[model samples]
Target: MSKTFKFFIPCDKAHIVCDKAQYREASLWEKAKLITHLAFCKICRKYTKNNTKLTDKIKESQIQCLDRKDKAAMKKDFEKALKDYSN
Candidate 1:
């Protein structure tokens, strides 16, 4: 692809670029192309909008998770319980 026309990517390629942009992994040129594609494609625009909303929701959710230490403790307890039951 020519350097000047690199920003005219297809819908599928645009979606991939959009995802990379969401993850902060896309290059500047890729982001430009995705934006351009979104401008002309309503479906891709909607897709991008929904994707952004989903990412925001995930970030804003008050979900908690176990740390590595907690996970290790639970694993040890489970293993000990299994061993005791087997005996």
Candidate 2:
């Protein structure tokens, strides 16, 4: 059963932050209080340890080219084929 955590603080309210440790351990009150703490403190929010948010910029790079040895072998094969064709 999901436990409902209730914390009403002035300046910021109704902030819902899921606490993985408490939620995994089935502690609803702790999760609710964490949500409450996060609502007021940005520093605590920044330092919160969890894996949900991946804020890092990810880039997809692809390299399409032959390696040095393969390139050399291809060049040699092309040269041999050209020589055979000319003869």
Candidate 3:
């Protein structure tokens, strides 16, 4: 494993690169190395596949979240209840 070919990245580093690649934050060289590593590493390949599937499922889910106004109202109500209970 020569430094020039950058052979055999560790599993920890590969997982980091995998995450970065998923988020489109990995550099070209890093992505290339990760892909190459995946070729021979079954665990990493499955991890990448599962991660991608999870991301896709999350994206497909149409779950709605409360906006700031609703959050603020809830906070206010909680605070009022706490104050009343304290007194």
Candidate 4:
């Protein structure tokens, strides 16, 4: 929620990397954030692989995640977590 890190994380598409070289295999920070987000945000976890398209399961899960309400807020949290991971 800090203005400094606001742009780093979009409301969605955080799984989409802005720079592939920035994290490579991902640092511990990245991994930890990803893991934590995975626990809460199932859609991001299902679509963790950035190079590939979202899987059917992921799409379905994302739809389900959307259905649960808080769709926008969850996505924002997921993006912020991804930004924390990447940064």
lDDT of candidate 3 over 1-87, digit per residue (tens)? 678567668788999999999899999989888988999899999999999999899889977999999999999999999999999
Per-residue accuracy of model 2 over 8-44 as CA lDDT, tens digit each: 4322222223434423652566566766777777755
What TM-score against the true fold does each predicted structure earn?
0.72, 0.32, 0.77, 0.32
What ranges in model 1 sit over 4 Å off? 1-5, 75-87
Better of 2 and 3 by lDDT: 3
Estimate the TM-score for candidate 1.
Answer: 0.72
Per-residue CA lDDT of model 4 for 26-65, tens digit only, reads 5555544555555666566555644244344565675632
Model 1 residue 1 lDDT score? 66
lDDT of each: 0.91, 0.54, 0.90, 0.53
Model 2 residue 80 lDDT score: 100
> In model 4, how large is the Cα lDDT of residue 74?
90
**TM-score of decoy 2:** 0.32
lDDT of 1 at 71: 100
Which of the two, 2 or 3, has more TM-score? 3
Clashing pairs for predicted structure model 3, backbone only: none
Error of 3 at 70 (Å): 2.1
| Candidate number with the higher TM-score (1 or 3) | 3
Scored by lDDT, model 1 comes in at 0.91
